[model samples]
Target: MTNTKTNYLFFTGKGGVGKTSLACATAVEMVDAGKVVLLVSTDPASNLKDVLESPVDENIKAIKGTNNLFAINIDPENSAEEYRNRVTQPLEGVASKGEIKKVREDLSGACTTEIASFDEFSRFVSGETEGTEFDVIVFDTAPTGHTLRLLELPAAWSSFTEENPEGASCLGPTSALKSGKERYHTVVNRLRDGSLTSFYIVARADKASLKEASRTSNELKELGMGNQQLYINGVFKAIDKQDSLANEIEAKGSEQLKSIPGNLNELPIRTFPLLPYNILGIDKLRSLFNPDLQKSISESTVAQTNTPHQELTGIEKLAEELCENQQHGLIMTMGKGGVGKTIAASAIAVLLAKKGHEVLLTTTDPAAHIQDFIQQLGELPATLQVERIDPKVETQRYTEKVLEHKGQGQSEEAKKLILEDLKSPCTEEVAVFHAFSKAISMAKRKFVIMDTAPTGHTLLLLDTAGSYHRDIMRNNMNAGRLRTPYMSLQDQELSKIILVSLPETTPMREAGSLQDDLKRAGIKPYAWLINQSLTLLSSITDPLLKSRASAEAEVINTIKTSYSEKTFGIPFIADTRLLPTLLGNKEKV
Candidate 1:
C-alpha cells in the first residue's frame, strides 16, 4: 500500500546491511509493477555497477537488465571537479590566477565532494533532475554515519546561512550560501513530508546494526523525518532444533528481536529471512521479494561451490601474533559495516588487554557502539578502556582550540575570516580527523585498538588526513619536518590496519578496494580478517546453510591467498552480543 503512495524511497543503514540489494530490488519491483523508477546511489564506494551488471557512471542512463528502470551513481570526485570548474571557470577573466587557485583550494577536498553529492541529491529530491520521467526515485545512501550527515546538511546549512546572514563559511572563502539556502530548505521539507518520502532504516538483527539503526531513527525523528520504517534483513529461525549452530544463529536473532533497541521498537518493521546465498546480481535481486521463485540449490551445486581450503581456526592465532614483539602499537579494524568490524575489534581489544597490556579501545563511529560493549565485557580485570571520537564533541573542541591558538597572532580581519570558516560543517570533518590523529598518537604509549566508522566515512576521514598531510608538508617545507598523521598511518611498525570483511564476493572486493586505497596512500594493512565465516562447521544442518558454508570456502581461500600476507578467520558464532569465541565450537572442533 505504501509503495504505491510514496514516490521517494531511502534505503539507509550501516554498511553491508544489504541496502543496495534491497534498494535495487525495490526499484525493480516497482518497475515490474509498471511504475517507471530511477535508482540513485550516493555511496562513495558503490557496487551498483557490479550488482546491476551495467556500465553505470555519473550520467543518468538506462539500466540494461530491467525495463522502466533508470539509475546513476553520484560520483563524488567527478561532481566535485565539475562543481569547482562550474563555479570558477566564469571567474577566469574576473579574478587573478592566485585568487582563482585559492578559491579552488577552498572548494576542494572531501568537503566539496560532499557538497557536490548533496547538491545532486537535492536536485533529484526536489524534482529538478529526471523527476518528470520517473514515477519513483530510490536513494541507496551511504553508510549510517555519512548518510546522517548528508541528510542533515540541508537543514544545517539553511539554519547556518539564515542566522549568520553575511557568513561565507559553507562555501568556504567563496559564498554561495545566499542562493542555495531556499533550495536547501525546500529539499529538507520535501524529505520531511510523509506523503512523498519514506525512509527505511535497514539492519541485521544484531546489536551493532540495531543500536545504530535506533540512533539513526531517533536523530531522524528530531529532524522531523517521521516517515520511517525498520527493514530487518537476514532474519533467521531454526527449523532443526538439534543443529547447534543453526539453533544458536536463530536464537541470537530471536533474543535480539525480543528487545528492539531505542525508539526502533516504535516503528513498523518488515523482516526478510536469512537466505542461503547472497542476493547478488540482477536475477537474485529480482528474487528478493519472491524468494520461492528462486532456483533450488542442488547438492551438486553445493559441492561445486566448495573448495579444498580449510578455514583458519579463530581470532586466537591472530591475537597471539598481534601480541608478539608488539606490546604497544595501533591496530585499526577497517571494514564495510555489518561485516562484524565492531565485534572483531572488541574481541581483539579484550584479548590484548587480557594478555596483560593496557589497551585503549575507541571507535570513530558516530553511533558509538563500542560504549555498549562495556556491559558485555562486565568488569574487565585487564586494563581495557573504551572511548568514542564523537564528531560533534570533537568539532566543538577543535573550533575552540583553533580559535585560541590561531587567533593569538592574527589581525582582527584574519581572525574573523578564520572564525567564519570554522562555522561550516567542513570544520567538523577536520575535527574528526584531528580526533583520529590523537587516537593514533596514543598508540605510542599503549595498544590502541580503533574501530572505525563504515568504509565510506572512514575513507572520508583518511582522505581528509591525506589532505592534512599535504597541507602541512607544503607550509613547512623549509622549516623543521614534523610527522603528520598520514605519515604515522603509513608507518607499518607504528600502524597495523586489519581489513575486515565477510567471506563474500562484494564485501571481500570492497575490502580489497579499501586495501588498494590504503596501499596507494602508502599505508600497508598488517593483516586481513575474514569474519563470520561459516566454513569448517560440519554440523548437520539445513541444505541451504550447508551450501552457504561451502560457498564460504572459496572466498576464504581467495582472501587468505590474494588479500593479505597474514590472514585470519573468525567463525560465525552466535553467542549473546555476537562476541568472539576463542574456538568456533569446542565440541565440533
Candidate 2:
C-alpha cells in the first residue's frame, strides 16, 4: 500500500480502461492518509472536471472535501499558447515584426504543441512546482501511443541535441534547452529510478487492452524504466444463475484473465471486481483503494425507482437515412479508443453496401481492428472493399518517392541530412496525411467509410492536414490545387463525421471535446452514436445490470440535451451475430 504512493505515480493504459477513476481514487486515499498530494491530467481530452464533479482548469485548486489534495488540467492549447509566447518574447527587441510573426507561426504547429505540452510535463516531474509542498504527484496520462511518445521524448531530445547542437530540428533550436538540460536530465533519472518514481499499467480483462498494456510495458522497459505494476479493472462475476448475459460476461472476463500476455505474468498484478454502481464522487472513489471497503463494495447496489428509461433511436434509423439519400461521400467514425468506432464503421459500411452502393471501408489507425469486424460479420457485400494505410509501409514508400523526385539535384551532404530528417516521427505523420488525402478523393465516386485512430492520434493527423493545406495555399496559390483534403473535409455535405461514445462520464466529455475540435477545424459532425448502451438492454434484471442501466440513462439524457441533434443508442448484446437484424437489414453476405 505504501509503495502505491510513490513520489511520482503515472496511470497509463489504453483509453477507457478506468485510468482516471483509479488515479483519482488513489489520490483521495493518500490525502485521507494525511499526505499532501497533487493530481494532474495531461490528456488533451481530459475528464478531470467530470470526475471531480467540479470545474478544473489549468491552475491547481484544492479539492473541496480533501484535506491536502490539489488538482490541475494541463490543456494543450493553453500550454502551446504560453509556450509560444515564452519562446518568442525575448526576440521582440532583436528581430523584425515579420520575423517574429514567422517564428510564432512555426511554433504554432502540431509538433510544437506536443513538444510544448511535454515541456510542462518535464518541469512538473522535475520538481518545478512553486510550492514544493506536496509529498506525491499523480498523473493520469493519455492513450498508449501518445503516452509512449511522451515517455520517449527526453531520449529523443537528447539524441537530437547531441547530433545537431548548432542547428534546430522539428522542435526548435538546441540552444532553447541550454538552461533546462540539467532539469530534464534529473526528470529522466527520476522516471527510470524505481525508488523515485512508479509506473502503473492499468488495463481491463479484455484481450485487446491486455495486449496493449503488455506492449506498453515492454516499450517502457526498453526506455530504461522497467519497474512497473499492473491493475486489471472491471473483472466480472455472475451472482444470478438465470442471468444469461451476466454469465456470459463473467465467462469472457475469466477467459481473458487466464490468457493475459505471458510477459506481464512476472509483474505484480491486482484485479478489481466490477462494482454495482458507477464510481463517482469522493466516497465511491476512495472506497476503491481501501481493501476492507472493496470486500463489501460489490454487494452495494443501486435502489431502483418507478421512473422508466427513455427510448432513444438506434443505428437502424441512421442506416435507413443513408440508404434513402443514396449519396456518395465520406463517413468517418471517431472518438476515444476502445469505444466501438470500428464496429460502428463496419456496420454502416455493411448497410450501405447491402443497399447496392460502392463503399470502401479503410482505416488509418496503426492498430486497426477492421479485419476482426469483418471476421465477425463472416463476409462482406460485393460492393464493399476494405483497406488500411499501414504507417510503416507508407512511410517507407513516401521517403523513397521524395528521394527520387525531390532530391534528384541536391548535394551529397544535403541528401544525407534530408535522409536523416526523413527518419523522424514527423515524417511518418506527413506520409499518413497524404495517404488520408488520397482516401478522401475516393469519396467523390463512392462512399468512403474511415475508422480513424484514437482521439489524440486522430487529432494530430488532422492537425497535419491543416498544416499541409496552409503550405499548399501559401506556395501554390492556384485555385485548382488549393482545394485539398482538408477543404473537402470541411464541406458539410461531402463529409459526415459520426462520433461514437460510451455511456460514461469520461467518454462523453471526450466525445464532446472531439466534436468541438472538429467544429474548430471548420467541420461539423452528422450525429452522435452512443454505443453498447445498457439502458437499451432492458431485459437484464440483475441488480448489477440494473444499476448500470440506471446510471447509463442519466448520461444518455445529458447527451441528448447538450450535444448533437441526432443521437442514437446501440443496445448491449451478448452475441454480435444479431447486428444485421438489429440494423433492419437481413441481407447476408
The per-model lDDT (C-alpha) reads 0.80, 0.80
Put down candidate 1 lDDT per residue, 1-589, tens digits, no spaces: 2255888999998788889988998988888888888999999889888788887889888888788888999988777787788777778889999888767766666787787778777888877773348889999999888898899898977776775666453354234322467788789998999988999999998877788898889888888999999999989766557788788888888888988985988899889887767676677787778755554533345445543335575676677888798889889999887777777788888888888998999998786677666566557745888888988999999999999998998899888878876878788887888889888888989999999888877887888888777667656865355888888899888788999989888889889999998899889998888887767555546555676777787788788778877887776677874553433342332
- State the lDDT at 165 in candidate 1: 66
Q: List candidate 1 stretches off by more than 4 Å.
A: 1-3, 90-103, 130-132, 162-170, 173-179, 295-309, 403-421, 477-480, 580-589
Candidate 2, residue 317: Cα displacement in angstroms equals 3.0
| Candidate 1: Cα lDDT at 588 | 39
Q: Give lDDT for model 1.
A: 0.80
lDDT of model 1, residue 525: 94
Show the lowest summed lDDT stretch of 10 residues, model 2: 580-589
